[model samples]
Target: MTTSDIDESVRAELDRLRSSIDNIDAAVVHMLAERFKCTQQVGHLKAQHHLPPADPAREARQIARLRQLAESAKLDPAFAEKLLNFIIAEVIRHHEQIADQPGERP
Candidate 1:
């Protein structure tokens, strides 16, 4: 193939890869939203039971699992850990917000 043809082929491949990544990004965002909704539910449950907003053990277990999955997926484990830490922090904040509202459960 000519040089220009090779370049065109590579560009087509990149475009295809980018489209796949975009789709994955959308799904990831949707999954995160669903997770946040579950966090809100947990906040309500905790408030009702007079439990603490943060669950250290649960968070630890979650991080551990994520790290293992990251390793298996050939991804950066540290990045996965950091990401999960950030997510857990957000969950804590959401829980605290719900807790602060009047008549909110545990």
Candidate 2:
């Protein structure tokens, strides 16, 4: 193939790859939104029961589980752990806010 033809082919492939990445990004955002909704309900329940916002044991278990899943998926376990940690921190922040509302014990 000519140099110009090769360049066009490369651009086409890159565009296709980027489109797929954009779709995957959208899906990830939607899934995270759903997860946060569920966690919000959990936060409300924890607040009602006067439970602590952060659960070390559960967090440990989740990290382990996600690491295993990342291994199975052939993704980087450290990246998975970091992502989960960020999400967990956000969730705990929401839970703490719930726990601070009026009539909450702590």
Per the 3 Å backbone cut-off, how many clashing residue pairs does candidate 2 have? 0
The C-alpha RMSD in Å for every predicted model, in order, reads 3.3, 3.4
Structural similarity to truth (TM-score) of each candidate: 0.89, 0.88
> What lDDT tens digits, residue by residue, belong to model 1 across residues 23-105?
99999999999999998999999888888899999999999999999999999999999999999999999889888889885
Task: Give a tens-digit lDDT track for model 2, residues 54-102.
Answer: 9999999999999999999999999999999999999999999988888
Whole-model Cα lDDT per candidate?
0.92, 0.94
Instruction: Single out the weakest 10-residue window by summed lDDT for candidate 2.
Output: 1-10
Model 2: residues >4 Å from true position, as ranges?
A: 1-6, 103-106
Q: lDDT score, residue 103, model 2? A: 72
Residue 46 displacement (Å), model 2:
0.2
Deviation in Å, model 1, residue 62 alpha carbon: 1.2
Candidate 1, superposed: residue stretches over 4 Å from native: 1-6
Candidate 2, residue 27: how far the Cα is off, in Å: 0.4
